[model samples]
Target: MLVIELRLMQIIGLGTALMMPIIGNLSDQYGRKALLTLPMTLSIIPLAILACNRTTNYFYAYFAFKTLTDMVCQGSINCLALAYLADNISYRQRASAFGILAGVTSAAYVCGTLAARFLSTGLAFQVATFVSLFAVVYMRIFLEESIPADQGEGITQPILKEGEEDNIIQNDDNAPTKVPPFKKIPSLGYYLKARFHFNKNQFADLMLIGGIVATISQLFIMPLLVSPIGDGRLLSIGLFASCVYAILYSIAWSAWVPYAAAAVSTVMVFAPPSLRSIASRQAGPREQGKAQGCISGILSLANVMAPLIFSPLTSLFLSEGAPFHFPGFSIICIAITLMIAFIQSLMIGRAPSTSNAENSTEV
Candidate 1:
């Protein structure tokens, strides 16, 4: 049973990793609002289907649709939102903006989990779906585009080129010819080349490495969802934990979950902003998108792999009848590693006027 579950998770992970980048790329071409709305709206269909599902085949179908929609919504819409925030905010204020976003998301997660526990799963899902749909509608109707239509076309050449007049705008005839649509949207070979040829700056490199390490660490911890004990043993542990959580949640006298969620959210909000701001200050505005994209991509990959990698580890630990020490320890190690990387990045900041020099270069 464990093996089969692990394999299923692996399949899900690979599918997500494969699909997320495509979604992100598509969002880059299309507007973010439409991409975001489609997924949120379509997500209801899968959840609604799952609510009525009674058979294993229906379960599989539900999982497939749900996972695919989540990959599209989360990968593309979420990534674009972050990039949009970065685009709009100055470097100095970005951390605060991210912090607020993180806090809201974290609070929502905690509240959502608690609500799911209290309400019927179907009802809870429906409410959540409606909320998301409403949010999509609100954003579509009211939210302004941060990136101008013209600005989002692609990277513009920096104003100040060496030995060239700063204000000069070359005629269309003098500009390089645009590639044909076929060449622009190349086959697999071209896609691979484009992906691989991304030029990363120091901060981008740090983000990519940090993202990979953070993801692998998180993945190592997630499989413990089944616990270190066998399914029979883990079931009791999960039930107990859920019961305790439910009781605490029901009391409603204190905001324990919300507070914890706020802390976690705050961390997430600040971490990226700090990383981006420091890196952008070092690397410049132009390369910020690539750094953000690469980081987002790495995190998405990690999200995909977490279940696959952790499920087996959890099974192995459970088979051995040992307490699940690895998950906590792995998370600690990852935190330390990220902290060190962040510190190292700060240390590297003392170098000569490197900020604006590389900002305008295309990644």
Candidate 2:
């Protein structure tokens, strides 16, 4: 299951890396709302399939369509949504708004998970499909387009004018997806169950607690830190905090220690929004979608490399015939990745930023 999951992650990563930049640039040229509608609509078909029936034939059908839709929808909507916000909000207020957006996302995740626990799997999919449909309708009716589809500068701008598209596509073209691993690898839960004796109920409890922390930090504390500290520095801080969180969990001698690491997430959770905010500051209002898409593309490509490198390492280290007895070895390796990211983030502070969005101290 774990190997299969990792392979799936690699595939999704590769597909998204190729697709995200195109989607992003198209959103810039067309409109965020219209582009967003595609993935949101594609996502519904698979869910609606599952909701209707779960027989073997239907399950296979669901699996095929789910794979197809997930590749398109993963990370794509969020990129467009952030770009849409960047278009409307003042750069000064953008970080705080991004934090709010992330908070709401975490909140939804928490709420949905909790809700699903009480409902049957069939009901959960039905509800999810319904909510997705409602969200699409709500977005179309209520949300104003920042850059109208018809009024975009032109499709040629990002290609012919900047010449940055090659760099965007060529470099960072292999990072991969983070979200699908759980669904793909049920063994992850089984592994935790073996190591920590983590039962379903206990896992749910941890999620509830972690969700509360994530929601509060993203909504309140993160917004506070961004305006005063700047996203660059905040990103560094968050990355460093994330290292501690990962290290703490990797070497956790007791079950409680993992929960303690979740507490550190109060600060660690700030990294992603901070990174996105910094990226947002770098580009002009007109180029928001392109910039965001490039970043997302890079991240998706990174996902591809992640599984290829880590899956075997994890499988070997976790197996009984391992060279070393450290169950936490793979996790420590992940911490090293965070540390590398941390080092890169520090350079952001050293470099001079031209945008007041990154340098401004006013709250």
* lDDT value, candidate 2, whole model: 0.71
TM-score of each: 0.55, 0.84
lDDT of 1 by residue, 62-151 (tens): 878876675545445545565566556544344345434433444454455456657886787677767776777888899775432333
Per lDDT, the best of the predicted structures is: 2
lDDT of each: 0.41, 0.71
What does candidate 2's lDDT look like per residue over 254-345, in tens digits?
88886676787688777777777777766655678888888888988876886666656666777899899987777778789889989987
Show where candidate 2 strays beyond 4 Å.
Answer: 148-191, 352-363
What is the Cα-based lDDT of residue 268 in candidate 2? Answer: 74
Q: After superposition, which runs of candidate 1 have C-alpha atoms over 4 Å from their true positions?
A: 1-5, 18-22, 51-58, 149-269, 276-291, 304-363
For model 1, the run of ten residues with the poorest summed lDDT: 175-184
Query: Highest TM-score, which number?
Result: 2
The lDDT, on a scale of 0 to 1, for candidate 1 is: 0.41
Model 2, C-alpha of 4: deviation from truth (Å): 2.8
